[model samples]
Target chain A: MIRKHGIKLTSVAILIAVLVAWEVLPTALDVPRFIIPTLSDSLAELQRMWANEGLLGHILSTALYTVLGFLIGSLLGAVMGYLLGMSKFWEKVLSPYILALQIAPKVAFAPLFIMWFGYNSMPKLLVTVLIVFFPVLVNVLQAMRTVDRDLVNLARAYNLTRLGIFWKVEMPSTVPNLMAGLRIASTLAVIGVTVGELVGGNTGLGYLISYGGGQANAAMVFNAIILLTVIGFLLYVVLERIEERVLHYLPKAHQ
Target chain B: MALEFRNVSKSFATQGDGELLAVDDVSFRVEEGEFVSVVGPSGCGKSTILSMTAGLYQPTSGEVLVSNVPVTGPNSHVGFMLQKDLLLPWRNIIANIEFGLEARGVPKADRRARAMKELDHCQLSGFENHFPYQLSGGMRQRAALARTLSIDPEIILLDEPFSALDAQTKLLLQNSFAKTIKDAGKTTLLITHDLSEAVLMSDRILVLSERPGQVIAEIKVDLPHRDQPIRRRVLPEVGEYAAQLFKHLKLEEKAA
Candidate 1:
């Protein structure tokens, strides 16, 4: 118990030290405020933005788009993965096009989406969906391919229908991989939304950072970046909790 | 006959090797409630025979019949078990046992009661809520057996079901399984490399040659207390039966 407490204390200490350095180092080294703002300056800018720049609206917009994109992308990916897994002919026929799409950097599509959908939320949502889709699809498809053949044979021997086999055996077997893919996509969802917002968004935390940069206010930019990180971190934590609950039956590795 | 393989031969199409024969013209009959084991050297297609009996594999030529009907596809009348427990790790023990029943569309309450009874029969009563990974290897195999028995299949096809266990666990499981199967009067066909296991539990043993397996020898185990495998293990006749099977397999291996 003490060792556990010790580990927690060490983490806290590291966080405190980083905060102290952020506050103290800039002025101690006589660095200009525009180059590397002190922690106080960033915090003041955060308060000012809260009062004047509708900061809550930006945070909520980014969070909303991140969640919406994640849900839609995950659903699309899972459906496509199962469809492809079930039909080898279609999987073979479509693999080349899918591969080409996957190979191209997802962030590079942000500009194209913006061009097609204009500067509205559509581009950001589309970009987030694109970024989140591939990881889930790849992981689920790989999982479907490697499901235990013996188990499937056993199910067949019981005269389970093809749908029954898929529902009972194949689907449950791919869950671990599916959860893994979702976790990866959760983080990527944030990157996707940020890229879209950076390219053309007029609202959201990404827009705030871009706007702050244009105004040469490093402190405002720093505050927006910190808020964005918090959003991503919260999403990751939520996914991890869900994973723990869903995979409770799986044995944990020995510490 | 509960199970019959009439001149069944199985071959697979290899990528570059054309046709690869596994089992060649094997004929056998398993009477109702009889415990038969097919013992062979490695790669002798012992598993292929079980798969065909389960209707998972079609014979390249001839036929495998269960309860007088030729097996054309996966058969509802057959229960198959393999070396791996193959329990759904995400499911608790009772849920795993209920899998086959669920597939057959048994009512929810009926499935639970039958699965619970099998769990008790297999001596896994307290572990019903525990997942497969939480159980010991012996207990997991017991759950697997419960899963198979829950389906109430006419013929149980076992492909090296106990081969993965340690010697002690294997013997214990063999004794438990023999008693359970005998009490249920289920027709069981076991595939194994262990001659002693074949001799201990089976009423009759079929010895197959190496790859392109044929039923080279058939031994009738005329021993008392066949249901009690542990008791039968110490009998002088058991050793003799094992030795005979070993000789058949060794000779086949040498020829290969």
Candidate 2:
């Protein structure tokens, strides 16, 4: 227990040292505030944005889009994955198109979506969906292909129906891969939303970042970036908790 | 007869547009409540026969019947156990044992009670709530046995079920499994490469030729102590039977 506590303390110490360096380094090197603002300057700008620029509204908008896009995209991806996995004929016909879509850069379509959907939230949500779709689809499909043949055979020996075999063997077998895909898509979700906002959005943290950059306000940009990181971090942590609950049967590996 | 193969033959299509014969005119019968073992070298169509009996594969020529009825597909009256336990990793032992019953749409409470009884019978009562990975290899195989027994299949098909276990675990499991099946009076067809295992557990041992396997010899194990398989290992008759099987296999190999 003491050793574990020491390890946690070391992690906190590293975080604190990085914070102290961020606070102290710029002034010591005589750097300009516009290039790299001090920690206090970024905090002061955060307060200013909260008071005058509706920072909470921007945070809420970004968070809402991130979550909405993640849910829709992941759901579509999982459905498509299971469908393709079960049907060889459809998979063969659609694989080339899927490959083409996967290879294309998702973020590059942000401006196209904005031009088509206008300056509202639709373009950002679309971009986020596009960005988050492929990882989940690929992971789930790979997992479906690699499910243990022996287990399926065993289920068949018991005279399990086609749907029963899928539900009991195939679906449960793909869960770990599905959860891994979700985790990857979770991080990509923020990137998708941010890219959409950076390109054309007027009401998100990404928009604040662009706006701050245009005005050369480094402290505001720093604050926006930190908030975006926090959002991504929180999402990742939540997914990790869900993964733990779902995969409790798996034995843990010790270092 | 609980299980019978009437001139059954199976052939698979090879990559070069050629047909490879597996089992060739194999004829045998396992009496009801009797233990029969098919001993053969590798690639001798031992597993193909079991698959046909289980109705997983169709015979190229003849028929495989279970409980005097021709097997059509996935025979409901037959329970199959492979070398690997093949327990679902996501489920606890009791749930795994209930899998077949659940697939048959048995009521929840009835399946649970049956599973618990099988677990108790297999000496795995306390490990019912543990996952497959949490148990030892022997315990996992016992759980598999419980799962197989829970379904109350008329004829149990064992495809070298103890082949993957260590030597000591193999003997112990062989003894327990033989005793359980005998006590329940279930007909069993065991396909194995182990001559000693055949002599120890089987009332009749069928020796098959190498490829395109046919029944080469039938040896009746007339030894006593059929329930105590491990003790049967010490009997002089066990070694003689093993030697007889070895000579048959060796003579077939030389002919090939």
Candidate 3:
């Protein structure tokens, strides 16, 4: 009611300007084709992929690994995060291992995963799960650990049991933070799958990019990049919508 | 006995430090359905005494008996409200009110029934769907009061409950609470810094001293119990009674 849509308008204006600049810059500089192709070339490549029947199959195959990894990783992260947040001892025990895994370049780990899981979708799925899991766990744990103590005390004083305390007090307070972690995790899941595929695979957006890159087809590479970005952004937007709908009660200061 | 605290003295000892007595030989009793407000200089552990009454702490060497039963932890029959209303933001007005009922395992239909009844009593009926963020400070505090009552506890322990409200809102809420509780005939122990509130609403006022809070004075309020606010506000006796409590607090402050 109080000028709620101000940010949306500003974001739209900035996006329009960026798109216009992207379309015009190559022509102004007389840039060579296949080196840094025009946005139109990338768009054309996208349309061609769309015209081909199984482009969606490639997208869907890639999507399968991403989604499966996201759901599994997020669930594990939330549960682990809750446990870790509640108990300092477990956090001390496991968080270091988690942090170590997080800092390890996931790209380098993809080859070892292929050797372990096979060169098909499983390695890519594992990579996606690994990429998305840490942030969700870390963010949720921090949120749960730092919940307002006075409110907890109030609940305790009112004869609320431990289970009651969790549902009524802790979960609602931790949600917005948890949702942010979920959003970050979702996009990273996509990246993980593609990275895994690029390392070793015969299909998916990652494989398509590899196929294009090896042939020095910059237009094809940019085309794949554009599609990947759209996939990531669209997934991010949908999850964000879910987050917004579920956590309408949380204050904006939450994230 | 309705409630009793016998020779309950408490002190805290820190690492490599001498002991500090917070309440020394504090003792008190109140009859059922009686309104008693504990007043003192700010650091006199008036709140500690309230905590003791609510079974939040044990007096170092004494027993706190509520309805002749010793308090080991937060007593099931006692409900507490603090200076600030601690309403959960995620729950709407009705859900916030229903939280205690949910904790106590009341069925959803029954909980809704009770919450509806409480809403009518608190005059918050149509606002059940509004979240805490949508409500004013006074409304949130009223919702908190409703939450406390929903547990259906026999005794209510208030720790400086109105200290956060604007003076006008505080007065209004005290009047509202006084009227609502009188109809329900519930026992209440109110701890407040405001002398006039204690004088205006309580049956007896326990004035306490600094550091180890002790009952320095007990003043019985002999005001009319037809208890209409309009008439009570104009009475000359109200001013004199409030002044007496104020003087005792100041004297206790100087003594420490």
Candidate 4:
């Protein structure tokens, strides 16, 4: 119980310690302001960027694209995973295509996507979907395929139809696997969005990181990376909590 | 007819042995409401015989008849409970029992009532809402039996049903085995490796040779089917009969 909230405190402490070190060490070393900005210098830069420019809006803009891309990618992956799993013939035929897509470098398609959808949210969204779909699809399909054979045979001896077996047997057994897949997919979805933004996105965290690098504002690039990483962490933790609550009645191992 | 195996032969291709014969030219008749058992060594293909009877696997050279009609595939009127209870964890007891009805496309309302009736019959009325994981192993087997009986199958094929249980539990279960079949007016064919279980529960026991399984003998059990297993075990003649069956099975085991 004590450890439940310990993670949050530990994260805050680590951030404070890094900032304190960043603040004190630069001044002590007499490093130039541009070369190694102090924590105070970074904060002042943030404040000026906020006041003189639409920097905060850009951050929010990037977040929106990330969230949208992730949602679309994750939902489609889950649906297709279940559909393919439901049919053996379809699984045999379509699973190879899905596997090939998963293994084929997602970035290689980025240039092709730019040509097809152009440098906008569409290309970024497509890239995000490509990255996010594989984890959920693979996990969900495996979960469905690997139901206890005895249970299925039992159902059959009772003369259960395919639909009946699937609803009462296959789906429930796969839920733990589904949750695991979702957890992984949730994190990957963010990566997908940012990658899409990096290659062709105009209004996401990916674009900001690239824009910062192009302008030689290392501080802004660091800030974008920090914010994105925090968002990714929060998304993962939140989804995991939801999975736990939803699967509370499920049998758990003595961890 | 309670159960009939008409010159049944089951053969499967082996890696090096080429078309390994499991049960060859086997014919047996079980009377209506009779409790019959087939006892053999581990590789005697007792399960294959049971599976053929249940219509899970087909006999290569013959037919299995329950009440005269040949069984080609799974029949709704035939209940099968394997060694494992095979209960779906997601479903509660009532729903698990109703799985048969769900497969048959029985109406939801009727299945609910039928499930309740079965639960009451199995003395698991209060546990209808409990999951398989929550129930005791004995209770789970009881529920599994209820699930089988719910479909009102005339012939129940039990393949190594008590093999997974502990010795005390197996003993307890073996005691109830005969009474339950008699009380339900259901003909039962139990396949087991335990000689005592076959003698204790069966009205007639089929003894088979190992590997390329063949019916060596059919021994009649003269012990009366009683309500309690402990009392059944204490019967003076029961032990002698079990010992006789044990010697036959053991001799075959040594030869194999």
Per-candidate local distance difference test:
0.91, 0.92, 0.83, 0.80
Interface RMSD of each: 0.9, 0.9, 1.8, 1.8
lDDT of 1 by residue, B1-256 (tens): 8988899999999999799999999999999999999998889898888888877779989988889999999867999888999999999999999999876779999999999999999999899999988898999999999999999989888889898899899889998999899988999999988788888889999999989999999999999878888999889988888779878877656778
Q: Candidate 2 on B1-256: residue-level lDDT in tens? A: 7988999999999999999999999999999999999999899999999889888889999988887899988857999898899999999999999998988889999999999999998999789899998998888988998999998988999999998889999999999999988888899999998889999999999999989899999999999888899889899888889889989889556778
Supply candidate 2's per-residue lDDT for A146: 91
Error of 1 at A223 (Å): 0.9
| DockQ of candidate model 2 | 0.78
Which residue pairs clash in candidate 2? none
Give the TM-score of each candidate.
0.98, 0.97, 0.90, 0.88
The candidate, 1 or 2, that scores higher on lDDT is: 2
* Residue-wise C-alpha lDDT for candidate 3, range B61-140, written one tens digit per residue: 88888898888887568888888888988889998898877767799999998888887788787999999988878888
* After superposition, candidate 4 runs with Cα above 4 Å error: A1-19, A22-68, A74-98, B14-17, B176-179, B251-256
Count of residue pairs whose backbone atoms collide, per candidate? 0, 0, 0, 2
**Which candidate wins on DockQ?**
1
Cα misplacement distance, residue A8 of candidate 4 (Å): 6.8
lDDT for residue B151 in candidate 1, whole number 0-100: 90
Instruction: Write down the worst ten-residue block by lDDT for model 3 chain A.
Output: A1-10
lDDT by residue (tens digit), candidate 4, A3-60: 8689889999999999899989988998876677777776776776678656777667
lDDT of 4 by residue, B1-256 (tens): 7788889999998798789889988999998988888998888888888778777779999889989999888777688888889887767899889888777778999999998987887778799888887787888888888888889898888988888998888877766655566788898888887777777787889999887788988999887654465666778998888778878877656778
Ranking by TM-score: 1, 2, 3, 4
Cα deviation in Å at residue A28, candidate 4? 4.5
